[model samples]
Each structure stands twice: as structure tokens, then as C-alpha cells.
Target: MSFKTKEKEAVGVPISESWEIDFQDDFDTFNTENWQDQRIWVNNETHCYVPDNKYGTREVSDGTLKLKVINTGAQKPCDNFDKNGVQHPDTQYVAGRITTKNKHEFIKGKWTARLRLSSNGEPSMFPAWWLLGAENNESPVQEANENVCWPLTGSGEIDIFEHHGDHQKNHYTTGAIKSLGECDKGDWWSLRKGFDVSLNEYHEYSVEWENSDLVYRVDAKEVYRNVGQGDQYPEKMFAILNFAKITDAPMKGEWVMEVAWVKHEFRK
Candidate 1:
């Protein structure tokens, strides 16, 4: 794996600049080394592993991470597996979702990931690039179960991106901040007209944050922005790349999420 950093100034915004982290895993060098480092704590404690149900397994082949939602009957364990081998049936088919806990945490910065989303005759496939918090208090079970302690009303969550296959050409991304015993929120956007169904090409989705502001983008174009919105924004949060299933959808199906890389950079 090779790491390349590039800095460029935005064409129209004179003071605005951007930096990119390029990881060309042409030889799968980073698969075992850096990939493990990027796994987030939230996913780890939640038993989110590869090749599960909605989430699956991702293999490093041909210089890219091929995320497949497969149904092999092997009982995959959560990040914290016990010796009893007691399987969490609720977490079956949970695969291919990675977070940034038990490793590094970012306070405020820009995060972007490149991916190719696909559907496999499965109707409820949801491929998303979003952000969620790491429940870092009390027992792992209590932390994951917001209703048991924090309650859903006060639990903080910031979903930067979410798109479903059923909503062809109409996807929305959300952001939420919990404070004052309440959760403040922002409106969603309707940006989904330029997607190609071939599912073989790459697309970049990014979220930029600074202080109490945030901007979400697709294919490098700004889609949603919140200024003075959602409880001063998320100071420290982790991003997620997942292809999930819509349990309530009329038709049920499966999907795969393939990714090139996820990059993060700060403005100076």
C-alpha cells in the first residue's frame, strides 16, 4: 500500500482548500495492516462483522475491497466473542460494516469514502456512508441498547448519509445532535438523479464539519449543509460504510458494498 497526500485549493472558493488521502492497495499490503486499524469501536462492540446478513464480507482483490452480502451458514462472532459460543441471533447476517473506535477518534474534520454500490435481485438493499456515535459508557450491552438507559430521545446520533435501493434516484442524508435532554435535527435533501445502476463504477461521498457547521456531499458535489444546526455539531464522531437491508420494505432483497478507500483530512 502507498500513501499519497495532495492539497489543492477550491476553484471558486479562494480561502477554501481540500486534502486527500490516497491509499492504492494494489498489492493488498494494507488489508491486514491498516484495515484492522480502521475498525471503529462502535462496530466492534456491536458484533458488526463481515459476511453477515445485511452486512457481509469484504475481500481485497484487484486493488479494491469487494464487499459481498453472502449467506454462508457459519456462525460469525461479534467483536467481543465469548467462550460459550452462544450466538446472537439478532446479529445474524450482519456483515461488512467498519467503524473508527478501539483505535483513533477524530474531533472535527472532513471524511470521505469512495465506493461502488450494487443490488442482487434483493429489493431492500440500503447502501450508505453515514456517521454514528460510539456508545462509550457502562456495559457494552447497555451502551448499545439506548432504550435501556439513555432512551432514544436523548441518545445522540448523526447520520451523514443514507440511501436505499427502493428509492431510486431519491436518497436522503440526516444529522442529529442530542442535548438539553432533546435531539435537534436538520432537514433532508433530494439528490439522487445521477446514479448509474451498473454498480461497477466508483462514487465519492463526503461529510465536512467545522465547529457548529456541516456539509454533506455526493460525487464531490455538496448535497446538504447545516449552519448553527443540530446542537453545535458532533465534536468527535466516526464514519461507517454499510450496505444494509430494509426490513420494512415491501420486497426483501440483498446488496453488496464495494469500496476503494476512506480518507480524512483537516483544514489548516
Candidate 2:
């Protein structure tokens, strides 16, 4: 629970000189104006996202935002049914998810967050910080015809940080989902890296997007870069922060992902 102050720097470019802050949240308080609590459940995930603060789905305190996954001990039929009309049991576990859809959408820029995850590593916990095209047809937070189904168009998806607790400690994954032909057939181009980082420690995760190049970084150090050329993501994208449970493995009482702050900066 110790907080460490680290300098924020961008590789090859000085943050202060090359970038201008566009959006930021320090979690001093939950700003509903900037974020919307997402309640839909997909991805065959084990938890149902709820807006209830009592369930620890979302809470702000001590200058940090905590998105928690809680076990409710009882199962309730899910609102979203599967392809076969079978409803999944969802209430056995409830988690939190929030997005900036339609609130703060931006095109090419730098998106970053400072986070510390619960160290329990239940193998079922999945925490992620990502961005989706504002025009993505999935939720349609914007216009209808403006919808572009996933990786086929727009900014696609940029996963700045993803931690699958099932993996070895200190391992994380980052990547982009791009269209191959159609939205259903997209490529999940990604990279995995391991560090000495512990889940209990705070670390900065970021992605810098310039034209067609993307640079991923951890604490200002470069980890991976994507130089592929196909379609340049020219549309605005919104941010999503969530902690999902993807397994049926018996989980501890509760799991949490604490985020100290999030920021978006555009080139000046």
C-alpha cells in the first residue's frame, strides 16, 4: 500500500514539450460526468458488471479509484442470454466496468494510467485498460450508421495494459486488434513481456500512437512497438477500464484493481 512517486517521461519525446494534456482523472472523486458505468455482460465472463457501490463494483477514496470483483455467494440468471437462448448464471460474481464512451473520445495521442492490482493472482481475475473506437458498433455510444463493427474500421482496439492473473507473476500483455477482412475475422496482434513488477506495486502503463506506429511502454521504458501498415486509425476512440473474471476457479472473497490516475495527451 506504499505509494511511490515516479517521473513521467515519454520515450524519444519529452512529455511536457511534445504533448499537451487533453483529459485526466486523479480519482479525488468519482466524476460521473466523465465516465459511464457499463452494465452489459459479454465475452463469457463469469462476473456481471454492476453499478452498485456497496458490492464494491466502483469506489473512490484516498485519491484512488478501486474497481472490485466480489463474490455474491448466490447465482442469479444473467440478463444477456447465450446464442442458444440459455442464460448464464451471473450474480455469483459481480464486478465493475466503466467507460468514457462519448464523453472523452480522441484520435491519435498518448493514453496512460498508473495502477496497482491485488496480488492474490486467482487465475480468474482479468484486469485491463484499453481503448475502443468511438464508432464501434458494439455499444453504439454515438450515432447508429456511424457504427463500424470492431477491427474493420476506425481506431479498432488498443490494449494499453492487460494482466491475466493466471500467468506467471509480473507478466503482462499488450496489443492491437485489427481487421483482417471483416469484423468477425480480425487479428489479435499482441506481445507479452515479463518484469520484476509485483501486483501490489504501482506501475505506469502507456501507449503512444503516431499515425500508423504504436509504442508501448512501462514506467517510461519501451516494451513493444508496432509498425504495420494497412489502415490508419483516423477516428476518435474511447477508453474502458474494467476487471473481469473469466474462469470458474474458486476465487477468494474479493479482488481489486486500484488505479491512481489516468491521462490522455495529444501532440502539441
Candidate 3:
């Protein structure tokens, strides 16, 4: 399938005159000042996030950001371990993960991105574009947090788009996670009709956050809406893009998630 080019105008739900573009990236090049190359591991993932281009972690070319998952036969030492307390002497896979942790953040706005994921169905390759509250304990922005744990207090998570390679060609998921009773039991909320997005074609995924509700859309079409739980996410959040290896699906070479651009507009 052919790739789609970037659009000249913003392609999302029409904004009122009061809304203004606050943050945008066409990805003409890798802007180090706006994104951090996160290398820490979590969630029992198999790949180690690295900044090296040779490992197929991050690449910017022709106005696009390519976050790739690659297999390197050589064993690379890693300091982090999974829940089982098993140390990873050497990792066979390396991938990309970048976040706007200490850069740009917003409380209520319209966040959107245009991207296409790798069509490789290896079940292990997981690609996602999501947001996390700036006050999260793991947040690189130290000033935003006041000793708060994850998914509670000032920390929340919003999954704008996520794709599992094992699913159908046009299947994906989007949802929100809210803290409940100190993160011990959080609520996982999702759309009634989960996302069915084409893997090889570019599409726009977005969330319109307001005081009253959170509306999720794909290509400007409303897919889901949450009205009552919007108050739980009062703190500002930052963006994250990554491709992780989470399963035993045998991988041959590489998997890529190409991003054309990302934008955030807020109401004045």
C-alpha cells in the first residue's frame, strides 16, 4: 500500500474561533528539545528502548518520524528486570520510546496525530501513541509531581491509539485508565465499539478534552464519548509514542510505526 502525505491544513473536528494551535510537529527533523528518548523498561516488555539509530530505534526522514522495532542477535546488558525478578543478561530486541515529559503539556485541549503502523503480524510488536499525566511519579518533569503514585492523585493515562499485531488487519484499541482507591484498583474504560483502523494507511486519532466530557475520534468521526469521568483527569498530560515487544511472537527483522505529524490545540 502507498503511504499518505502530510496535510496542509489541520484534519480534525472543527475548532471554534477561540481555539488556537499551541503545539505542533510535522517531524521535519528529530527535535531533541521537545522529546526525551526514554530508555527505562516496564510492563515486562522484551525490547530495550535505546537511542541508537542502528538498532532501529528512532529515525527522522522526509518529514516523518519512524519508530522501529529491530532484532539484534548480540546480547546487550540491561539493568532493569521484570516482575519475576529475572535479570536480562542480554536482550535480543531493541525499540524506540520517546515522550514529551518535560516539554509540552496541557490540561484540556484537542490532541491529535497522523500515523500508520507496520503491517507485520508477529503478535509481539505493540505500537501505541498515548498520553500520561505530567504529575505521574515516573514523569520526568519533577516540578509537576508532589510524591503522587501512578494512576492516582494527579496521574492518569489516556490511550489514543494502540495496535496489537495479532489482531485483524484493521483492529486496534483506545481507552482511558482512572485511579481508584490509591491505584490498587483502577477502572479501565473503553469505547463500546473498539477502534478498527487500517494498519498500512495513515489515519488521524484524536481526543477532545473539555470540562464536560472526553470525546474520541478517528478522522474527525466520533467513535466514543465519556461524560462523567472527565473530572478525574484534572492535571496536564504529555504525549508518548513507542513500539514495544511484549510477547513471544517470532520476529524476523524489524517493525516500524511511521508518524507524519502531531498537534495540540487549546481553547482560548
Candidate 4:
């Protein structure tokens, strides 16, 4: 296994004033006009994605959005299903996943979210801040144009922040996922980089196009760059926030990822 990461540090990116905010949500409340709960299984992720804050899996308070993974301690019936219409098994874990799929999809802009975990990373916790192509053909396919499958023309993905708690605390990986020209065929580690950061505190995670290249940042500071890979994701995309339980290991209490805000910016 080869490594595709950089040492965490600020490399400096010139602040551009020519950009203006295009969309924003400060999480004054869980506004259905801008987002919707997404309950589909794809990653083999262990927890069931639930809606309506069932078991306190999602909450908005103090002007922030909290996506949580709650341990119910016993199996509960789940309504989440896969793309093939197979229902998820009754689960001991329930979590929240939200997306802007049909609400705020846009192309060629800066995406940013200020968020943090409630505690140090622990086993099985998988929290993410990312974007998926609007035309993705997963469950809840809402339109005729939304038929593109994964890693294809309109289904490419970009992860701005992902923490694999099974690895280490205070760390995350961010970058564009390279498409391999077929459904579900994508290179996840090629253009991505894992970085050390304080997970228990808020930091702005972001990805923006620097011409044809892609720039990844933490708190408005550049940390990594994937040269000329931005061309693969030209389709409109939308944001997502979710806390997943990815392993069978039992954990105490619950895990939380808090978001202060999410926004997009475009050239003026």
C-alpha cells in the first residue's frame, strides 16, 4: 500500500476577493427548503441512516447542526434501503445523513463547512463533510437526468473532510476521488491526502478549483493540492453531512459531528 498524503501545514493560498458567497445555511434551524435527510446504504457502513432525528441522530441547536450516531443498545427496525430495494437489517446503531441533492446543487464553486467532533476519535466512528454529484443514480433518484452511476460523468465524488476514527484522532483526509471510467470504479486514495488536525474543535474544511487544479484547505489555509484533477467533476454537485458507524466494534454512548455553517462561493 502506497501513501498519498502530505505533512499537515499551511502552504499558503492567496485570498481571492473576486469571489462572493452564492449560497449559505447557518443552521438557524433544519430548513427543509435547503436540505433533506438521505437514508441509503452504499459504503457497507454499519449504522442505519435515519431521518427526523430519531434517537437524537440529528439535531440543530445553538445555531449549529449536529449529526450524530446514537447507540440504541438493541436492535430497532430500520426503514433505510439499498439501491436494489433491500431493507437494512434491524440495527443497534442509528445515525443521521443529510444532503442538498435537489435543493442546492451547483457547479464550479468553493464549498466550505465549519465543523468539529464532540470528542476524540474513537473506534468505528466515521464522520464526513463531502459533496456528491447531483445526477447520482442511487436510491431516491428524483429525476430523469439523475441516472448517472458512481464514478461516471455526473456521479463523481469529492470529499472535503473525512475522519476514519478507526485510524487516529485529530486527523482527516480530503481530496477529489479519481474516477476509473466505470460504475463504482473509483480511486479513493490517489488524489487524496490525510492530515493531522484537532477534531474536537471547529475548523473550516473546504475545496475550491484553482483553475483546473483542486485545492484543499483547513480553516482557509491550504494544506494539499491535487493538480488538474478538477476537470473530472464538472457536473453540478451538492453537499452532505453524516456520522456513520463503520465497524462492528461496540462503542460507549454516542458520536457527534457539529457544524456551525455550510456555504458555497463563486467568482464575482
TM-score of each: 0.62, 0.86, 0.86, 0.93
Candidate-wise lDDT, in order: 0.48, 0.77, 0.77, 0.88
Off by over 4 Å in 4: 1-17
Clashing pairs in 3: none
Per-residue lDDT of 126-199 in model 2, one digit per residue for the tens? 89999887877664345765567667667377788887888766767787766676755667653333444676
Query: Cα miss at 42, model 2 (Å)?
Result: 2.4
- The local lDDT score (0 to 100) that residue 156 gets in candidate 2 is 78
Model 3 Cα shift for residue 257 (angstroms):
0.3
Which residue window of length 10 is worst by lDDT in model 4?
A: 1-10
lDDT of 3 by residue, 43-151 (tens): 6788878866766589999999999988888778865544345655568888898988878888878899999976655677689898887876652435734456667
Candidate 1 lDDT by residue in tens digits, 44-71: 2222354322342655666666654444
Off by over 4 Å in 3: 1-18, 79-89, 139-146, 189-193
Candidate 2: misplaced stretches above 4 Å? Answer: 1-17, 80-88, 140-142, 189-196, 229-231
Models, CA RMSD each = 7.4, 5.3, 5.9, 7.3
Error of 1 at 69 (Å): 1.8
